[model samples]
Target: MPKPEHPTDPDVEISASATARELRFHARPEVTVHAEAEPGGECAWGSDRTNLPDQVEPNVTYRDIRIDFRVAAALTDPTQDPSSP
Candidate 1:
């Protein structure tokens, strides 16, 4: 397996409405994982939710969300000389 390269920073915007809450991350992420846990138990990895309910009551406080972007190995290869052409 090839090592992944660093991805560019994504543009994140958070907004809330009367009916719902939304989080928009502008960029194509290679992998997106969302986890919601209670006060003690661990939250397993899950798929991204398009419709996440607004915070009604503070039941769970700890949450983990990760987004990963992978670049092609050919683009980040250091062995190839750029000026060789």
Candidate 2:
């Protein structure tokens, strides 16, 4: 006896309001990250962008080398936060 085969079909799915955080990119030699609680609210330092590649690679996938959510006393304090990260 032989098993029966079924026809395969492509399935489509859509997503809305993904839970993942979006990465912000910059082409400048240096970058500073900041986040605000709300409009006109206190702003805080997010992270320091450094050791950036001189040139972006083509047709190749990239990932963040390091991500530090560990906020410092100054970074956490909006009043003491610097204009740049």
Against the true structure, candidate 2 has what lDDT?
Answer: 0.31
Model 1 stretches with alpha carbons more than 4 Å out: 1-48, 53-57, 60-74
TM-score of 1: 0.18
Q: Write the per-residue lDDT of candidate 1 for residues 10-36, one digit (tens) a residue.
A: 122122222223344443335443433
- Which ranges of candidate 2 are over 4 A from the true structure? 1-34, 49-55, 60-64, 69-85
Write down the lDDT of every candidate, Cα atoms only: 0.30, 0.31
TM-score for all models, in order of appearance: 0.18, 0.21
How high a TM-score does candidate 2 get?
0.21
lDDT string for model 2 (1-85, tens) is: 1111211121211112212233334433354544333322333222322332435444433454333332212113446545767
